[model samples]
Structure formats: structure tokens, C-alpha cells
Target: MRTASPPRALVIVVVVLAALLGSAYALGRSLVDGVPEAAPSGGPLTAEQPTAPSTGPSASPDPYQQWPAEDGPYGARSTTGDARVALTFDDGPDPYYTPQALAALRAYGVTATFCLVGENAQAHPDLVRAIVADGHTLCNHSWNHDVLLGGRSRQTIQTDLLRTNQAIRAAVPDARIAYFRQPGGAWTYPVVSVSHELGMMPLHWTVDPSDWRAPGAATIAARVTAGTGPGSIVLMHDSGGNRQGTVDALYRILPDLASRFHVTALPPEL
Candidate 1:
């Protein structure tokens, strides 16, 4: 139940935009494709400052002994920096509602991540392209809506994930899909391990508004407003159900959150 992409890939004229929300802390580092950053409140390991030159080569071996990525402030480094937050959408590219959601995001000047399903991406590559064009990040959800970790072989899960990656990359060659959100946010240790080895990190949302259940607009707004804080990842949906409520709530929430705080996107833990 998806549309085939036209022979000519749509040339995306993405307008540069994201919702301009407040930031609890300044950006210390950018997002590493798939790796999520530590929230501001938690204690994190940061980079070591340069020490003065010693007599001969410093007594220490390669100081970068640790997997620098998991420790880097920018790449994979973790550090106790400033407070930050990111708004992310899942199960999207809904022909009707996704664009509305994107418009809301654009209106507020906040960038977000769209965890795309393979079939959805194939059906609506233009929207995916627009997400990238507008400067938002693209991440893989799965090839289908199936729970990849459970009731399946490792090869099955890998096939589903990799196929989605290929689909996204084919649609938007520039799409840097380093993040993977398991279907239903469900994942086994093996799934996470394989994902990391595959150059992606598992993503977990800190705040889930549960808009999929069609919660009232006011309630959704309240949850989004309350859940939002430093280093908080908010989860909302644009499809898989009646998303009109989601769209409406997003419009209202944007200005309200903007008046009180900086409605920014997540890329760094700065």
C-alpha cells in the first residue's frame, strides 16, 4: 500500500528551518549520527584538557585508549555539559499529517528527527527528502512495523534494518542514518549490539506523549511541555492513526513552549 517513486528522483528544495525553542545549555558537541548524548543533569565523562609538555614523550601511552567515540563530546564522547533537548517523530511520512507536522516544526524553527519506516519512505520519498532539506535528521525505524528483536532470527532483524537503511539512503543520498529506533521502541541486547557494530546507535526517547492513542490535544500539549527539559528526547507520532490531533497539538505547543523556552533540535549535548 505504497506508491512507487517516480523514475526521476524528486529534487528537493528544502527550506532551511527548525522551531526556535530555548536551550537549557549551550551546544558542546554535535550528534554522532546514531549516538544519543547524555542529558545535562547526569554526570558524564568529558575530554581531558591538554597538559603541559613533559621531559620526553609523556609517560602515558595513547591517552585515547578508551573508545573515544563513546567518550567524545562531539563524535561519541560523553561529557557533563549543558542542558539540551531534541524533538523526534516516529512512524511517519503519512501523506496527510506528516507535512502538517513538519510545517509546525518549521514554524517554530526547531529541527527534529524523523525515524522513518522503509515502506513509508518508499511511498513518500519527497517528505523524507524535505526533512533532510529542511535540515532535520533522518533515522531508521525498520523495514516494516514488525518487532525486529523478538520472534525473529538475527539475520531477519538485520535484513529488516539494513533494507530500511538502503531505502533511506537511496531516497536521500545525504541522509546520515546513524540512529536506529527499534520497532515499538522494543529491542534486545543483541539488537543493540548488532546495531552499534553496524555504525548505528539505538535511540530511546525520554518523553513519550503517547499521541498514537489519540490523546486530547491539551493533554498532548501538556505532556510535551512538561516532559521537555534539558537533554530530554520527546517521542510523538505523525502516522499509524488519526494524527490530526497530533498536528493540532503541535501547532499550539510550538508557540507556547517558545514563549517560555528555546524550542531547539537535538544534535549535540553542548
Candidate 2:
């Protein structure tokens, strides 16, 4: 005999229950898979996390940024960008005249910048020390005062500037040579660019008295005082020959310059 089939109502109830169970299973799987995993302990921060802002002192401003940019010969700086006047002496650190210059500066309570030659700095480290000791700014004037330094190859110019800087630092151990002045004011693009690469400002002058010619003290003094105005970088010399006139002229120039304008050395940390 054949077996009897199940009732229709029972079959329908069983089918409905099986369908509900399958739907429930799918919903649960989706819920579990959609959740994101947590980051590991002590791991790097995730995108949702942000770093805190710093609370210490802000970085110092670049002094050169405020300077006026030159049009030709590669952006050399001539002015001090303010009412202050800068007195820069070139080819210096001579044993005889440097002392006199320093004495005059000391007497007037004024400081100036010294653009030194490599050989001179090397030979007279004591004078370099004195320049630093007097709190004057330092500049690299090239090795041996080569007027044709800017016309040479880039590497040659860079090497010469670096060697001069090295000689300067050897004397003071912590000299801050912030400027490079080409000898004879013979500035070129290569020299200026190399100076920037070496972390120095290419310095020029506004007022030149031709004091390097050993002009009489009265003449040097008259020219400097008359030519100088606000933001002037007066070019004078302390070495390269007898600088007695330049030294003596300082006695007259400093008093008048100090009285008229705010005279100061170029910043050592440009």
C-alpha cells in the first residue's frame, strides 16, 4: 500500500518558517561584515585623528625678505631697507689700521661690518678676533681680494667664498658671515647666485667715497658725510694699504652719522 501525504496547512506553515529563517541569516551576516576593524594598540593615528598645534616660539623672520630687490646683476642688496645706515669696511683686519678703526668705532659707541679677505683673515686671526670681540658683523670679500672673482667659473667663485668663510670661522670658531661683497664692486650673476647658495646676501653699497685711494681724512669725512643719507651703505677700507685717513675720517663721520641717522652694523644673522 502507498503512504499517505502530509496535510496542506502543515506544508504551508513549514515553508513560511524556512523562508523567515533564511532572511534572518542573511541580515545577520551583512551586519557583521559591515562593521570596521579597530586600529591596533599604540599604532599611528588614523585619518579621524589630528595632531595638536605647537605652542612654542615662532620661527624668526628672514631679515633679507624686507630688503629692496635690485633690478640688474642678480638682486644684490644695497640699502638697509630703513632709516639706518650701515658702515662697511672692506679688505680689512690689518694689524695697524684695523686697530685704529676699532678704536674709533669704540670711542663713538658705534659698530660696523667688516668685509675681510681670506689671506688677511688667515694671517691676522687676532684681528679677526678683535672684529668679533667688538661685535661687528662679518662679510666675505673673497680670497686675496680678487676683483675678477665674479668672472671666473661658478665652482671657482664658490670655492673662493667658502675658503674665505672658513678662514673667518677658523679665527672666531663661531663667526656669522651673513654677507658676501665682491671685490671692486664687480658683481655678476654667477657670484650673486653662488653667494645666495652659500647662505649669504650679495651686498652692494649706495654711497662710495673712494676712501680706498687713501684720500685725506678731511676729504673722506666730507664725502662720506655729504653722500650718506638714510639707508646708505658707505664703502670704506681698513686694510689694502695705509688706511690712516679712513681711520681718522671715522672720528668725524661717526659723530655726524650717529647724530643724523641711526647708524648700525649689518645684521649678523640675515
Candidate 3:
């Protein structure tokens, strides 16, 4: 009654403006509550914890390191508990004598082990092939018969052995060299260890008739026959000098050896 409605339109306008303000305030609150908060500088966004660093030992050095630096193993001189004797000729494949020895061995129907000199084997590849063809085993004798070979560095020793083996395989492509004999039987720990690492048994001699000295044939025969026994590994030479004595000695010794103990080459596997 007093002021009257200044304008009915003005009243309507005020009501609409108030409704708009309320709607805006509600929308702002909804937006603020829905937004995600920023993560702290150094903290993880998710709840899962990180794993800690490991403190365990790293894997052991490759057990198969080439030629162990230090030596602990040694080669075998005689085989164990077998009633067999092995004839091993070294420094061999001589053009003059190895064939003779082979013939004598063939006559007796015997197989033998030849620890061949690298140079000699290379020179007489035919003999190496003959050795394999006759079912004999091969042993690696260092290239030059270096008596102090084992005293050299591991790499040197390894190289010497590998080179000899290479020469052997060059002659008889599939030759199975099962043993390694250091020149002059100068076996050191390094020599033995490296040999075994190379998949060969270390070979030492139980019977050395000193035939390399070119003793008389009768003397060589007597020595070999007297010294040989079950499990004996007799060492002789087919080269490195006149070996007529060795050839003749073999003719005598092999027949007696066959009649007594079972003379044979080394077992194919160690």
C-alpha cells in the first residue's frame, strides 16, 4: 500500500538475479571438490611402495675362465685299477722310424698312444693319419719339446698346447686327443690345470725306459719289459734321433707285453 510495487517487473528481475547467483556458487563448489590436488614434490602419486636396491652378491666369475691363472690340478701318471698297460711314444712320426714302430705294433695287433711333437706331426701328416686309422689315441706334446714350457705364463702355455693340438688336427681332421704331456715330463700345476680345462687328461709316464738316449735295442727291451706292469704307462721315443733301437725294442717288448698284461691304448674317455 505504501510504496506500492515500484514496478512488478523490478520485483521479477530481483528474483531471477538471486536464482542465478545461487546456481553459480553451487557449480563453483562442485568443480572445486571434483578437481584432483597436485602431488608433493618428491612423493609418489600412487600408494604402492618402491622396491629397495639389492645388496646380494653379483654372479660368480665365469667358472670357465680360459686356463685358470693359478694351478691346482695335476695329470695322471697311471690309470686306476685296470689290468692294462699303455705304450706311449713321444717326439714321433719320424720318416725313418715311426713307420717301423707302427709296423711292429700292427704285427702284435696292439694299439698305442702317440704324444706327438707338433713339428714332427706337421712334417709327417701321413703318419698322424696312420696313427688315427689304426685306432690309436693322440696326446698333445708341446711344439718344441720345451722342458720349461709349464713355467711360462698361462697364455703362453695355453697357446703352446693349442698350437700342438691344431697341428695334430690338421693332419687327422677328426683325431681325438685325450691327453696332454708336457715336454720332458716337466709338469707344473699350471700345465695340469690348463690341460684339464682343455678337456684332456694330464699324462705322466710310469715307465720310461730312457730310450730317447738311443740305448741298445736289447737294453731298451729289457728295461721296458722289466718296468712295465698292470696300469703302467710306458714312455718311448720314435723320433728326435736314430730310433732303430726303439723299433727293434718294440718288436721284442710288444710280444711279451701282449702275452703278459693286456697292452692297450688309453681308454677313449677319461
Predictions in order: lDDT: 0.71, 0.90, 0.84
TM-score of 2: 0.74
Best of the candidates, lDDT: 2
Q: Candidate 2, after superposition: displacement of residue 225 in Å?
A: 0.5
Global fold similarity of model 3 (TM-score): 0.72
For 1-270, candidate 2 gives per-residue lDDT tens digits of 999999999999999999999988877887899954545567768777766566556756544444447633458888888889999999988999999999999998999999999999999999999999999999999999999999999999999999999999999998899999999989887888889889999999988899878879999999999999999999999999878899999989999999999999999998
Per-residue C-alpha lDDT of model 3 across residues 106-184, encoded as one tens digit per residue: 9999999998889888888999998889988899989879999989998999999999889999997887888888888
Sort the candidates on lDDT, descending order.
Answer: 2, 3, 1
> Candidate 2 clashing pairs?
none
- Candidate 1: how many backbone clashes? 22
Runs with alpha carbons beyond 4 Å of true place in candidate 1: 1-82, 148-151, 268-270
Give the TM-score of each candidate: 0.67, 0.74, 0.72
The C-alpha local distance difference test score for the whole of candidate 2 amounts to 0.90
- Candidate 2 C-alpha RMSD relative to the actual structure: 15.4
- What total of clashing residue pairs does each candidate reach? 22, 0, 0
Query: Model 2 misses residue 61 by how many Å?
Result: 29
| Each candidate: RMSD | 29.7, 15.4, 20.1
